[model samples]
Target: MATWGPEVVAGAAHLDRPVRWLHVAEAADVGVMLTGGEMVLTTGLLLAGDEQAQVAYVESMQRADVAAVLLGLGRAFRTTPAAMRRAAERCGVPLIVLHRPAPFSRLTEEVHARLVHGRFAALNLSDRIRSSLTTLNLSGAPLQQLLDEIAAFAGCPAVVANLAHRVLATAGDRNSLSELMRDWDRVSRQVAELVRNDPVTVGPDGWIVAALEARGQRWGQLVLFGHPGSEESGRMLGQRAAEALAMNRLLGDRDRGWEEHAAESLLSDLAAGAARPEHLLTRVRAAGLPVNRRTFVPVVVREPAGRAGDKGDRSDKAADKEGLPQLLDRILAEEAVAGLVGSIGADGTAVLLSVPHDQDADAALERVAVLTHERLAARGRRAVVGAGFGCTVLDEVRRSFVEAVHVADAALAGPAATAVARLRDVRLRGLVRLLRDEPELQAFIERELGPLLENAPLLAVLRTYLKSGRNKSLAAQVHHVSRPALYRRLESIQALLDVDLDDWEQLTSLYVALLAHEAQQAVGPEAAW
Candidate 1:
């Protein structure tokens, strides 16, 4: 109390150390009876004339890591002892002395009550945060909502970043977050290094980080930027927020694997239209995909038919399939393309390239295509890559992805000899593939090719003839038959169908029917109506 005229006599620099508790000890060797962080109060009754004991006392206090030593003036020397003060200063332990008589009991009672109250308040705050986050989690709140809540509690920006130091989501004031992100590339690297080296929960500059982990696998980190609170409380908030996120992820995708990479999750959501465009844009930006004045190119790569199991061994096929995403990622990185690459359906990989407005989008796509084909070919796999129209608006990115998927299907169905296939390249075949599910298309396929449906030999000859663009000579060579024999087969087919083979309009109809039939067959027999 001010009435007691308390003054710091030594080690004033260490006054900021936390006081875990208060202790009253008069024994010369009282350090053994106490734990660390206790502020010791004494009258110095035993060490009145012993310098060696005084020095030993301060050394023992230092060893025990006591918070400070407070000496009452009356019973001890009238003023602070030179030996003890020097020793305290030397030990860098706080030493506060009462300039007048002060009651130790009252001082302890007051400080202890305040300490208890503070601890109680902290517990309440912790419980409140935990309950709020738990409720949010149960209600199926989105990841951004959870991050926003955490940011509100922390009074600062919050960031969720993958292991690669890419931000996956962020929350808090836009201006403040923008300031933080302006130098995120450097800050994130430094923070990642610090975390790796020390693994401390509370980092430099009031940054509190908690690892998002489950079952001993860590996928990302939750960071609270510059929390304006005691380190203990900041760490509590961070750990609680991290737990909520991890639980949210676990409950969000329980059936599938929880270790889905961050890029894949974002791309998948974008393609599926499962999340709002604004939300997806936020995620895209946070995921480190360029958004401003950028061109978005959506591409899909499909594995050749029968290539998955071509190795014959199930494990080999599984390994190959798993490496597809990684393979695409490597190519993207090596080519210096800013993109999100991930697996789509069973045999397709999707990539969203963010090209700067100043860069040529076509050139970027061509570079990616060349490397992709070259790398996949090196692995004894030739994949078909289909790219959609490049767009500048983020809202239209999902449409691009859908279009890319269509182009990929068309490429698979038609004769695509290029490294990269676009919508125009697929031409009539692409149109048929896009509308292959139409009832009219199915009916037309049946009406035009119904006569040859059951006759395997004649159907093969007709398909070969149509595919050769009415070239009877090439059709005969392909079927390994004489021209006369091919003519006879064609005439027999014409007689069954009761249609003239030489009619231009009739030939065009048959060609479209073949395209539709092939497209439907590519999807499988179950899709046929």
Candidate 2:
């Protein structure tokens, strides 16, 4: 951009060679710039006219690679020095003598304006390209799409790598570039060292390297293998592109956060039966959560009661869709029940879970409870908790949640134990044990209804319904109920047992066989179901 054209040369009387501008303010500094095509500019007050002084100036200029020598003619000398011009000519450098004082201030202004204009033009182009990329929402667009754009923009191959130098994405001459980056780990380390020297590198042989950075981290290096005309210009463009690409990745991450949240919520709902279990299971599988015949345990937690001085912060107890489920998954590991729903309740968390098969379900659940306590404790959280054994059916699971909640409440009220207690441990099974000790209690039930009393009315009805070959009217008449009422009662019994009565006739026969259980209890005391 400097005014180094022929017109500037024509103004000089004796300078016929081209002028390559090189500022030389120190006499000893010429050796640093010695690679040809340069014109040295200096005040020339250092010359004392001795032959040694003339030779020193001439030799220094020649060594420093100046194409010409420019001396201000307005200073002490009335005419151009004869020896200096001769010396410059002998060294194959033009001698430029300024007559009538050329205005350096004007020359500097022109040169600066041209340089600023060029930089501004390049910046404006970069901005336009950035705007276009932004409009396309390509910041985190697929890596392939970004690479294709980069390749197209550079008119050459482009590659994106991670900190480890693994090629994350590439475009244009992918085959060649991928092969080059196959040892990207080594290359990245080398590139990082190169970066300390300069972000921009132009080889003596026609190669350019534009260091790439994202989020202040050196992600990788970009090589532009071609002639270097405007090396700085290309570097500027590449920098803008790299920044845009980083921004794109940030935006993509932001959007993915929302998506992951939604997914967790949906899966949580399905696992809890708030939504259809089948539908949610499908979704879980799609999202990569396995749901096979895994044993599942459900846990219910009670949210903390707001104390008098407390400002409400139940938000932590809400199904966090994030931290809590992931924590549960980590604790459950392979034993985790399928279709697990982790929800934050008013005073707790409800987890519908699955686990692997085990002989002692109680022992298994106790271990999980211990792990759960440990996990929550590690996070400095203490919520009232309960867990239920894994169940195969949905109805059994729903009832189990209620039982688990009761056990959790009981556990919280008493001493804290690492083991999870089951509802059966505290309820039906406990009651059955107590009643099994007394024969008088059992005899009273057997005397109430004779054959039906021995089997119980519900059991007798179920047996009649099955023996009559699933005939509703015959079964209903024997049980002394209308047809519709019999169907309703059958439904009720199925609900009570938490099993499908219609699933098998053998179950019906077994119901009949168990009829004399109460009478048998009279013979030898045992618990009744």
Candidate 3:
């Protein structure tokens, strides 16, 4: 939108030869006028001094960017200096002198009108760009919407390419690009090489070729053919669009965080028995997670040693304390072992690890445990992990998880133990199964049998009877007590336990409780039932 085109010289008189448009200005400073690409316009008052100075001034104008000199002859010095005319001819600069009062007002009006037209053109282009961007945002569409809007504005076919130089989105006559995109399997090498080679302008087609790179990542290119717009302008707009798309992706990370939170909440409920694992699985599937028979690995995270001086309390803060369950979800999401892993336990203590197919599940569990531990460590906490044995069925997942927790608890009980133990490998398995957490039974035993066990003879007799499978003869033989003495010990034990010795279930319960107590006594306070 330059105001001074070559045709502006058409109206000016006293010009014998055709003068191409150069520039226009009235600055007294010749250097400023030249720098601004303006022709000099002034009366000959500059020639009022000596003739040599006049020749030097015209020579300076020749050396400078003054394309033409328009002198108003009616004002100031009324005549052109012969030295100035000789310098102009020598420098090949067009020189004209106006005798009558020149039409300065008309020339100013023309320049002003052209300047206004240029501003209007720029304003119009900006409005078009804003409208296109607004339409793209309003549609809430993907790449195609932006391309179509921009293409329509430029009156051309537009194409979006990915990092592989394959077209991701396209508008207008797409046959040229479609062949390359849809046939990517066949043309991947060619496309990769082509983009890497350089930006290529398709020949004779008026198409501009440019690359699409964002955030230091090369996303590919966008091409527009037969577009009636400046190539630089179009590239600038497209780059802005690319940046907006990347920003949208970044903004979506929050939504992903919320999803992880909801999934973790669901997992905690299932582990706590408030909800079933199947319920969580249902929701997972509904959310487009392909989880069918994922094995459950129940981990127990705890505080690390440095948290406080007291090492006895190894329990970490609750899983929900700092969105820990959600943290775990993000950690496991990118793992190869856990395709669609999530926590599904009460207290957010259990995780259901989904392994695609029957791969080496043990390795996967180890990886999951390592990652979980690392994450916990990073969070200024420590985790004690226990993975359940692999199960092919979902119904059995809950049971396996329960067993994993039990194993982990047992391992934690031993002061020397640092790692989780397999449920089958824990030496106290029998004792753990036998010990019941019924406070009523414990109270009855402590109240009634406390005095009997204090007496050595009565304790020996009771032990003999319990080990002999409730046989009186076997009790007497083992304890070296007479039949009558054995009868007396039986009566004492019956009174102590406050249960029928005749009933098999009661006798078995008492026997197991006694054995558990002995094991508990061996392990001390740390051995929990």
Best by TM-score: 1
Q: Total clashing residue pairs per candidate?
A: 0, 23, 9
Model 1 per-residue lDDT tens digits across residues 1-529? 6899989989999989999999999999899988899999999999988899999999999999999999988875887899999999999999999888888899899999999999998999999999999999999887767888999999988988878887878887776676667678887887776675222388777888888886668888888888999998988898788888888887686643333455676777665656556555656767778878999998888876564424556677668767888888888888898998877767888889999999999898889888988877766667778988899998787777777877888776553788889989989888887788799999998899897888879988888888787899999999999999999999998998777899988988888887788778765211121
Off by over 4 Å in 1: 49-52, 131-145, 196-199, 245-282, 290-293, 298-338, 341-351, 356-529
Candidate 3 residue runs with Cα over 4 Å from true position: 1-262, 274-281, 287-289, 292-323, 339-348, 374-381, 415-419, 429-435, 438-529
Candidate 1 residue 508 C-alpha distance from true site, Å: 27
Runs in model 2 with CA error above 4 Å? 1-147, 183-193, 201-230, 249-529
Order the candidates by lDDT, highest first — what do you get? 1, 3, 2
lDDT of 3 at 475: 80
Best by lDDT: 1
lDDT of 3 by residue, 317-370 (tens): 443334655665676765654533344433325566666555766776667667
Model 3 is weakest, by summed lDDT over 10 consecutive residues, at: 1-10
